[model samples]
Target chain A: MAKYAGYQSSINKAVFIYSPEQLDYKFSDTHPFNQKRLELTIDLLTSINALNPSNIVKPRNTTEEELLLGHDIRYINAVKMAGHGKLTEKQGEPFGIGTEDTPIFPNMHEASAKIVGATLTACDYVMQGLSEHALNLGGGLHHGFKGRASGFCIYNDSTVAIKYMQKKYNARVLYIDTDAHHGDGVQWSFYDEPNVCTVSIHETGRYLFPGTGTITERGSGKGYGTSFNFPIDAFTEDESFLEVYTTALREITDHFKPDVILSQNGADAHYLDPLTHLYGTMNIYKEIPKLAHELAHKYCDGKWVAVGGGGYDIWRVVPRAWSFIWMEMTDQALPTGNLPKAWLDKWQKESPVTLIPTWTDPENLYDPIPRKTEITEKNQQILEKALLPIRSKNSELI
Target chain B: MLIEEIMKTKIFTLKSDNTIKDALRIMRANKIRHLPIVNDENNLVGLLTERDLKNALPSPLVKKTVENIYEQNLEKLMITNPIVCHPLDFVEETALIFYENRIGCLPVVSGGKLVGIVTTNDLLYTYIEITGATRPSSQIEIRVNDQAGTLHDVTKVFTKHHASILSVLVYPDSQHEEKRILSIRVKVMNPLPIIDDLRKEGFDVLWPNMPGINRL
Candidate 1:
């Protein structure tokens, strides 16, 4: 238990990242992603008296210079001028502000910048050693790229944070992403960088949308053997999820010895999520921050910054899962007690058709993943192929 | 009911190069009093406790560095052989070991390797009664291609036998990729053997416990 102190106190030091400006960031009314989701979490924490204003920090906007750290300069300029305006040309496809997934609402640039700002603030807290842990639920836009945006994400907060940590602190960073979808944007940006060890465990790209987390996509040049991907089959549950993550995390963290860990926590992998087939519930989501916090403390003297990603079941699941994240960060786990009457009353008024569960569903419905299955075997082979050059090389320049 | 339900997966371990002070820091962080020291190979070497650290410290006047403290022959401070267990250790026996030795934790092992560690807290967490101790008298065995939800059919058979399973363990058959052997222990009120009853119900009862299997 003494080894847990690194995490215990670190988890206690988390600063909840938010901004009143988050209300301007809604994508569409048809989509479940909106500002009220964050408000619900704040309300829940406030009602439970877990909300400490001292621990809350408003997000900071990234300057165009910092934005250029991972993004194209032209892209930044386009976003600034667009300002909730739509982009229709295929050349502007990467800047997904005009598409169906990413609509150009009013204050589009400002709202996206706030999300990036929240994550950037989280990174600053960890980098400066002011706080060992911080979380921004509005970030984790893992699918964004340097010149383009895809998958309902605009700015790649994780990539920007990584660049900031590297450029500012000169510290070795281990970026572990736990979002359901592939961390394609983050991966592509650091695919050739050595100082950053990227390990992503997600549902196999096959049989899933935007499928890209194949095992064979290991980094090239000096960054060989630095990128690791564990693409598990669809419908994976809690136990198997834990197994794969534990194995990957233990090995990768030992190999990397990171100075700070930036994790993209996406709650969309929950069984209730409409988009994914993975079956983890609130328990798994809750367990992750605790483990990540523990591991960060153990490996990196408790330096960690967690950002929220893709979770669409706003009223029913996202708020609850992230609240558990808040609870984990505070070192006070949310109990099985009934949801506060006031919160539930407000939740019903917010979403009329959704059924709010009183307690966390116990079943993760997990089973062992077959290592020898054709799909897994094929994926392992592909990953091995991608990582072969890395394994053979000695050092990768970041 | 079984140790599998209540074992901690993360264990507290120290590398050899780490000082006794370092070990103590880890122990304090985890709120644990014990640490299992391992070499680079992850092989267990010795155990250190808070008592060892206290004893190793010198008098107040002689301010010594941590390296100097270790150089003062503190090698003799650790407990050499600590008790360990497999992940599948029975809960009753594990609890007995804790009581008998007055130890709070048992480092779980698999294939002579450290897979996880289970403490009293883990035992307590697993003891939450979601359902009563339902034991099965009928031992049903089957061979089929191992796939997800393969046990669903066998679970259905147990439901028909009016059996409540107390514990279940799966062991893979060495020669077959498609086959796995599962043993289900169930709780039954009647002394009458249900092995034959399950066999009559078309289950392949290859291995049945002899009458009077130890309950505790």
Candidate 2:
């Protein structure tokens, strides 16, 4: 593997925060949000020799006290009861479980707590200078609310991790999410805080689940101008997706200049992802982490923490897309040509669909979008609106 | 929903003789746009809005004016005998009145007295809540024949799955005049099973019937 572009070849610049227990946060075998993506991604990294065994860190279970940072006491108690099969479907309904979305599963509380702790572990590694960057692929449950779970998210790891950073380190954190769906839980968590800045670029709420990420949702009260949402139109391809992503992220980061950066990397925006309508390919994933690496070094002294979010195409899309972040963070060049034949040969049999055995997706992922011109224009308009507060503030200083 | 249920009852009123400055102060302090002018007996006389004040006052670019418009009498600017609604009036009718009259607010009156005020913002928020976009839910759309019992037929599938329906709306299909599109937002994120059930029931479940669902 070649060293990444314009980066020093450090032995361990980032840590792989994971434990097999994170896989226990499963809903069901047929559920779209599968932790099997985590296994595939780890294998891809390991096969390329990009993931260092010395840097892999096992996570601890989140203390009930830490879970309290981002959840209601009653919700936590209810989750505990439901985990042991003591809570009934009727009792779990009000808490957003046992529904078609998040049906009750065994040991859900223990599993969710481990994911939360993994995110916090990554945060601690970066904020405490133990590592320059960290990746917790099990975290990024962005739809979990204060008391309810939605969108297959049980306990919002990113929300708890951000609050933990604030309370423990007193660090001004910047959260960046590029999932196909809106990061509603994390956005609303710090909607009124001035210190934490959240930026989400997703398919517009008009056609996505948990629809509430309009540009008008800028942080309220003193937190005004801190929250930014770039809800691009559906069927947005890689070029347009990267346009809004790179521009908004750079502008928002330049304005906020936080002490640390936390990115929620959800690969569901891929063209093959059955859940989302976005047409992003592996191209956007390459730039997604490259830019995060550049900005973390530029602003936060390489203090970056990333977590996984909503990606349904675990077999065909998520493995390749998520592996880019580790490669970028570890200063390893994006693998080209065929993936390690051994990795593909092993996983292909288990994969329901054929894997793209190469570094790049096919030239023609889908038919050209008819509304490409109009969608790009509408996305540009949203980008301008989302940047208005920062632009005006910049002009005021001038 | 009725006017009284969602209307802001913490009334802010000013006497008819009050100056434009008084109205501006009240609106600025409370961040309200509409204010009702009441008589001594608390009967609604006129209404004043931020827009009317803006029109009456000189522009900020105009540094000097011979007469200060802020001190002008409210009687000269307030809309006299402004359209009002009853406290018991349906919100939908009030919304229609708002659209038909091209007005921003309607003062709720009962027995010929000022009760409360409802604004365009309030009505829009009510609709937002009714649409269930405020909650975390996944939406699905199905195209069905433009006939009665179609909605019932579609909802039966959702009922069998015990999926809580947040909101259900009927929209006209743009290309097919003989068909109607039924949009439903359900509380569950994994709407796959319900969508599958709808499709098996012979309804064309659009999954995400939107600007991009059929285009690409």
Candidate 3:
């Protein structure tokens, strides 16, 4: 917990963008992409006395025009029709609705639009100088595409928010996705735009979903060298994961010199998560936000908007991991020792698996990854290749 | 996919009597390495490559007068009757030809004339597309016995999940002689359900294979 020291004094102001309606962005009870994680995380922050009602802001419903910023009108219409039970399976197939990952539910368009608007609200708060930072635990649907949906995402909130910031505030955005899967939607949306830079560090596509995040996927046209990806090997531990993340973020921030920072905090890299195969523990969660907090203040005047993405282990992983983001955003001292008894008692009854009773993961979370040395070396090579252009530029300057 | 689907119809070509300087100018302007030579009837006669032009040029260290080097006709340097392909040929077969012959480009001939050209670059792009890396999807690899109907048995799980299969490639397992690996790219982000179904069907899935840990 001492690692979070010195981040408090630099904070100017922070706000939390949330609303009960955001929970409407649910696919089903059995779906892994559950919104219950949001409620649980908010409760954990509340129980710890880190988040106050006054610091919370209600999110607005995104207008069709705003949704059109990153989505096709036809696709939006199809989503609306599917929500109202008017579109058939065949009709919704092309739009990525009526699928197992992103099935149609009641008012799907409105629910998805609200999530998009929540991220936009976070961005507006930070961009308009109302707050130095904002957190939207309901957003970060990074896999939603311009014409269709993939993964469990319907409307891409991060992409829409970036486009909004570019048009309204005319600010250059640097998007950092620390998810297990590749941030393909947001990366492709800004692939050709010079002002918006996207960096995603995830499990390699060799076995991961949405397989496109390789070291060679830099960028195209004017945006060449703007996009960066660091796909580490599966079963990568905390040290190797954080090494690539921290080094790449520092170099990319300095090279791009963005006006603001947008981070997609997907907590599925934990060992408890059932979706992906990254062997990360709770240590990476603490370090992930610490770097973002320090770099945002140093580079973008503390203008940062944080959003949630994919995390399947709702009870044990998502709540603790997401609360750390809000705590880091508001410059609060990190929590240590045991979890709050009241919070644990309430969630333990509902959680099928026994809840972890500490702020940090226990030792020996998983068997020692057998190929730790080889995985670490391969990740280092990837990091070097990704940062080659910027390193060369720095050498030339010297 | 057919060869015509990936071949480039907008070609940079030269005539039989064209000077070496003309070939050099076309290559440089277009940033191309190969050029097809044609006759008066617009029929394929020969092929000129940058390698051929490099061999024909005089050495830079030579002080002797060599103005005639650039004026030499390309017919003297071009390879007559180079390997050519037809438009209807399968792209996979064309790839085999490229691999076996160790060539970079193939001129597509139809009706006794050159219609298009397929370079190594185009074939590589086709491979990328076939793997579905250009789209957003997850890849799953399954190890199964090299017996009959293994593919049919494995694909049933994907059909149960209604997950669209973007690409399916069957390759021999190097370590095991009797086992084969089915590399499938499906158009979905969450592949857990399908992976579970595969495991339940007694198929060994080698997803994210940890080097020393043998989970299978």
Q: What's each prediction's clash count?
A: 27, 0, 1
lDDT of 3 at B187: 83
- Quantify all predictions' global Cα lDDT against the true fold: 0.69, 0.88, 0.91
Encode model 2's per-residue lDDT on A198-244: one tens digit a residue: 99999887657877899999999999989999988888888899999
lDDT of 2 at A159: 94
Model number with the top DockQ: 3
RMSD per candidate (Å) reads 21.5, 3.4, 3.7
Measured against the true two-chain complex, the DockQ scores of the candidates, in the order shown, are 0.01, 0.55, 0.70
Q: Supply the TM-score for candidate 3.
A: 0.93
When summed lDDT is taken over every stretch of 10 residues in candidate 3 chain B, the lowest stretch is B207-216
Off by over 4 Å in 3: A1-12, A396-398, B58-68
Tens digits of per-residue lDDT, candidate 3, B118-199, equal: 9999998898777757677888888899999999999999999989998899988888999998999898778888989999
lDDT of 1: 0.69
In CAPRI terms, where does candidate 2 land? Answer: medium
Question: How many times do residue backbones clash in model 2?
Answer: 0
Per-residue lDDT for B161 in model 1?
47
Task: Estimate candidate 3's RMSD in Å.
Answer: 3.7
The top-ranked prediction according to lDDT is 3
Q: For candidate 3, lDDT tens digit of each residue in A347-374?
A: 9999999999999999988778778899
